[model samples]
Target: MPNEPTASLSPRRLTTLGHSCVLLELAAADGSVRRLILDPGNLTAPLTATVAVDAVLITHPHPDHVDPSQLAALAAGRELPIFGGAGLGSYLSEAGIDAVTELEPGEHEIAGIQVRVGSAPHEVIHPALPLPANLTYEIGGVFAPGDAFARPEGQTEVLLAPTGAPWMKLLETISYVAEVAPQRMVPVHDGGLGPAHRTLHTTVMKKFAPEGTEVSVLAPGQSLEF
Candidate 1:
């Protein structure tokens, strides 16, 4: 089957902010944009991207993905709905956020976009500790994995995947792409890693994908629109 037209897709653009952060800018068909922050690391092109985030989505309450100060700044200025698991919602409240929503692994509609929170765990966090519930989201057929194996499912036109710490194994990563069936996949989650670690990630993604999947590995400040 042919791909869905852009008009069918909610007016949304995915920008890779730093680390596991992704700026999801969703606009109404009329052109009003709703901004959502997924993970709170230093985002790429902050001056341009940060201005648009109206809602913030934090996958986990970790230091890298959840910055209390940033959330405070947004809450003080605007009424932003912060979405995450139950624990993360509590963490945001203590930080003074008024609008917060707790999401489990299921399906829902937000801002006219279909959001599916899939089951994922921090595979590499630790051996014995109870890893927080990790999430992978599907918005307008684009998969934005918080920090887990992003196996893009059927008809996924774009994929914003991770390539740094909290990443899946190399072979697993390849399998993820194979499953997603997206037209384009961009690598993210390198903002906090060192030069060598970043290099290794790039090399692995370049070598591991099946023949058909196209990987657009971007730097911090770059943008990819599907």
Candidate 2:
């Protein structure tokens, strides 16, 4: 059960880059740090330029979640793999991206990190709209369900809940958080929220989150260690 999440986890930093993108830096006992970028999209493109990343993770292939040109440029010759679900690998390949590693519902090692992909279908964006394959990323002491409300197996210390999206409401977010019941709930997918609205989300989520769960809101360019 070494890979299974524990009630308490070691220290790690989660840096919010607006929207779904974040820079996760995991520290090992030897003082070595591994950095990974999750959901590097249009909203976070500017910030990612200067940061060092060992790998890129895509939750889905939406333009907001995955920018082909940006990803192509980022992975130019670093030989870093873009870890994602089967669909993402195909999407990246068709987009002419190299070093694509498609994953399924299971645990795998990437860049010396234990990454897990959950088996869950994405929430309905719209009946008229097509839902591409979405990958849930469980790594670096945090669980990111891409664009879905699905939870990962075992316990997780932190959950990167999607708090802002046109496809969901406040109630759904609260319920999903309650269901997962993680020790910490950090709002992601919030690029669309303005100052007041962003504040509102933090306030409301804090109000209704499970008793043991704490809501931490990290705005663009903000970093929090947990």
Candidate 3:
């Protein structure tokens, strides 16, 4: 059988900072580069301090997705722009942090990078509990869908897939990959799993991923250039 054609991966650089946090760097036409941090809620040292972020993008207001102290420390003296969903903006403001821009589902340009926002319902964990709004972000060719199994507007060169969460299942995750059909898929939202479970999830995902799609699980502080 002929090999299936794979989707093209983005030329941008992606670095995983543990959990769902990612650092994305894209080269501009003038040889300059822009660096943006997404969901910097659980990043460890060294990686957290070394990354020179131009802006921060938060997908939701969950504590695991928005560590206020970490963000405050990161933006201590710098004029770092923080963008988040509507609910997140209110949460930050209530906490006395007013540096966040409320972004709805649309296209926006931030820190010289094109960002497209897509709305996706946060998986329901319980009937009584109110689910927070979730937003999926497509920055350049990298798509990070916060806590939702959402499909962005256009082609996804690199997809940050949530593998393990209270609101997700293995089968649903597999289905999401098939639906998005990206060239590359990386596992995120898996901080709660142990090493063995994490490895197992990665192995199973790689085995069942759609043809032409590459699934990679990065260790904390690891980076991959596509």
Candidate 4:
């Protein structure tokens, strides 16, 4: 069977704003643009001052994934709808933030962009420690899986694959990209790596990623069009 249109008519642009935080500017059929931010934690000055974000999506409530101070500053007194896992709402509320929409694993439309939410239990750090819920967002064909290894329910063209984290292993990360089989893979969740480690990780990813898959690592302020 021929492939169906993935999501919107216009092309989508994915920008890495440092770490797992990404800014996606999606084009509408009407020639307009809509911006959605995924995991706006540890946002850099370039992302904050330049990008005009329409909405925010959180994959989890981890400070690295949803830094309260950065989130507050990003809101800029505007009532932006923050979408995330069911627990994020309460977590944000406790932090004096109220503009959140809890999401389950399903489809919905927010800020004029089509969204499908998926989830998995966060990777175990310790056997006794309880795992927090992690969300995977499929916005158009751009898949951002937060910190979890859960795959999206539909086709993914551009995948924001996690590269470096406490819960991630090099072999497992490679296997994830192979399983998803996206046309383009951008490395994320790599804020903790230094320059040397970053280079080593990138080399391994390029060498081991599925054949014909394009794995590109975006710098803090870099953007990739898909």
Candidate 5:
């Protein structure tokens, strides 16, 4: 696919920051780039000190998906705007982040980058576990579903799919990919797996991916360029 608009995302590339965290860099005409990081949680490394992030977009309130310390650090001294749907404000406030911009399920121009928040229900773990609001994001045409397996509104040229999670089964993973049917699918949310299990799960996803979709495994810190 060709590069999308800078507001929507361009170059169509991303870097894996462990688990469900994905980073997108949008290049502008003036030779500057805007960086957007999603779901920087316990599974990912400390990104504030290393990555020049313009904004942080979160999908949920789960500790594994939203790290307050990281958010505070990322916002320190800079006008780092944090974006997320409902149920994420208290978590940020508890971490001393005073102001957070609420992003409802729709298109938004965040930090000069246009992002679409996917409307997805957070998967259920058990009857007793408290379920909270969840969402997915379409950054630069790459659909990165934080924890849900649901497909979003538009055509997905590239997909950042969750390979393994507590709430999902192997069959569900296969079917999700087949249903989305993006040209490129990268595996995320696999931190729960050891080497052997990771290999097995990824193999199954690759095996069941739609014929034209290529399942790519992006190791932590590794990037994929279009």
Candidate 6:
């Protein structure tokens, strides 16, 4: 066999945050870069320290997924747009954030980019009180399924997914990626947690990844181009 030609079908670049934080940069035919931060949990330190973002696509409002106070830092100094499910609007308003826009499973355009919100399941354990309206966001060939994982029907070049311990079951994560069928899949929501929750990092990749899925386990403070 000729190595299966993996390079031709893989993502161009990828950066992993210690605990499931990922920043994916996609190259547009027009030569501009479309950057997306999925589930920006506890990203305040990282963003302030080194990284600049153009836009943020939030899938849900879990503390690990959407760190309001920290995310606000990115919105500061520059006018960055934050897009999330309807629930995000309320949270943004309460946080006194002016640049946040909430989407309700529809198509939206921003900064010359097209974003589509797909459906996802919230925490099966606590489906009500913190009832999150999870979203599967597709923007410029990148798909991010915050914490939920009901695969959207479409073709995606890269997938930023939750492979951490708290958010999903190992098998469920594997099944989601299998269904979506992306050219490349990167794991998130991993070590962002504390010592008591480290096992999630191991289990996700060990148990969930499908046979053919390409998985990248990124270290904190690292970045990639795709």
Better of 4 and 6 by TM-score: 4
lDDT of 6 at 222: 58
Model 6: lDDT to the true structure: 0.64
Best by lDDT: 3
- lDDT per residue for candidate 4 within 87-149, as digits (tens), equals 898888988989888888888887888888888888877789776788888887888888778
Residue pairs in candidate 1 whose N, alpha carbon or C atoms collide under 3 angstroms: 35-54, 152-180
Candidate 1: worst 10 consecutive residues by lDDT?
41-50
Ranking by lDDT: 3, 4, 5, 2, 1, 6
Full-model lDDT for every candidate: 0.67, 0.78, 0.80, 0.80, 0.78, 0.64
List, residue by residue over 121-225, the lDDT tens digit for candidate 3.
Answer: 888887898978888898878898888888877778899998788888988999999999999999998888888888888899999999999987888767787
lDDT of 6 by residue, 1-226 (tens): 0111133433334556555456655555575655566667764244542445667877877776778766766566677788787778777677776687877787876555677888777756554555678888787666777666766568777777665554467667677787877777766666545655545654555465666666655556555445
Please, what are the lDDT tens digits per residue for candidate 5 over residues 129-194? 988788788877788777788786877988888878889998998888889889899888887789
> After superposition, which runs of candidate 5 have C-alpha atoms over 4 Å from their true positions?
1-10, 28-31
RMSD in angstroms, candidate 1?
5.4
How many backbone clashes are present in model 2? 0
What is the Å distance of residue 139 in model 1 from its true position?
0.6
Superposing every Cα of model 6 onto the true structure, what RMSD results? 6.1
Runs in model 4 with CA error above 4 Å?
1-10, 43-49
If scored against the real structure, what TM-score would every candidate get? 0.81, 0.87, 0.90, 0.90, 0.90, 0.77
**lDDT per residue as tens, model 2, 44-74:** 6454245557788888888778777667555
